[model samples]
Target: MMRVVPLQSSGVRGHDNANVDFVRESFDSEAFGIEIGRIRAAYATSAAGYRLLFKSVLQRARAEHFQQVLRRTRLENLEEVWALEATGFEMMDVVVTFARSVAPAAALPVWPDLRVEEATDETFEVIAHERAAAFFVGIMEDRPAGYVTCVLHDHTGEGEIELVGTLPEFRGRRVATRIIERALPWFAERCRVVTVRTQATNIAAANLYERVGFTLRCTEATFRANVATALRAQP
Candidate 1:
């Protein structure tokens, strides 16, 4: 197989627990700069040639004092999986992206005391720095129960649900679902297709999206290696 696009997000597995701020500074690294995501090469005529390329890249990353390294491939790419395993990389996580068309919907219900509304300056702090995105919060009795962060790409005609979360105490109450339900109309006004991603291991999250009319789009495997440890492994 041959390599293609090399875009990488800041090493997040797309889980709700991941604290990716989506700020440019968080992704910047001065120590080592190469293609950080989706590294692949042509299939090896012999196993030796392919494995050597991975070795060379990992070694260089380590030499540059990078603490950790990551690569992602589609789950169907067995050759890439095996190559990663052979080169001392361990599968960190698998993530699935889901998409749904945003159509006018009958309003979904929320708890009587729980208010699902767009975040205001006082309720959401991130809005101070990020003006283009939208935040919906589940406020029960004036206390924040959960929130969903969304972004619209006008050029692409798409909206991305960047993060979905509910406080630990608020779990199982459908707070997340209600917040997302509230966010949908906001997206519908700006884009037709909305997408969200969550870890494959998160069954509850996967099911939640489906329940909300999202269909599975794609899944990718992320492999991680400690720079020094990978370099020390033999073969």
Candidate 2:
């Protein structure tokens, strides 16, 4: 079973394969690049007995993907830690944090070249309308950058940066920070703390969060991939 929740609020599905095809193709590409080699075994259990198959591609791919992520988001050469007041527990920082790397694996095709768009897009408006705040679309140059879908609840008392992204072509230019800078005022009014959560394996993201005054509340192990000699084995 597969599902996709856009902006984490609504689940969007389609009968046609084209929609899912884009997603599946991206997944296969990412899996092949990072996790394809890790498949060890596959098995299924039933009331009658157990069956094992040597096709743990999904599992292996996940493991390998995460391992690479862990390596990239490593805490190295961290220099400073800054903080911004969003509300109470909600805070923003611009130090060495890793919130930049928590995006879905499908976006990996354009990884590193990504940048955030602070302008409003179609997706941002959908979320902002429900939350009653203005939606902003993050942009990189003339192209449409990543979009952040979020709003302030309870007035300015609670603010959420639901989705922030940096497209593959515009990364490494501090575009996420540009988005953060634009949204701080909304956060400062009501929320005690401004918070963003992402994958722990995303070192760039973690560093970005830290730089923006966010603290590491917790780290969870999610999303795994497999690595095999055929996949990651040295040529």
lDDT tens digits, residue span 90-191, model 1: 998999999999876676556686798776574364432353377787987688898888777543668889778889998888888878888898888778
Task: Provide the clash count, candidate 2.
Answer: 73
The digit string of per-residue lDDT tens for model 2 on 1-235 reads 0122222111122222111110122233454563222111112232111101111232233343532211111222121000001000111222222222221222212224444434445554444444435444565555666555444544234456656677877677776765665555544544555656675456777776677666764432222222233234322
In model 1, state the lDDT of residue 95. Answer: 92
TM-scores of all predicted structures? 0.65, 0.39
Model 2: lowest-lDDT 10 consecutive positions: 80-89
- Candidate 2's displacement at residue 67, Å, is 31
Model 1, position 178: C-alpha lDDT score: 78
Off by over 4 Å in 2: 1-123, 127-134, 153-157, 220-235
Report the error of model 1 at residue 232, Å: 2.6
**Model 1 weakest lDDT span, ten residues long:** 18-27
Q: Go through the candidates in order and give the C-alpha RMSD of each one to the true structure.
A: 9.3, 16.8
Q: After superposition, how far is residue 190 of candidate 1 from its true place, in Å?
A: 4.5
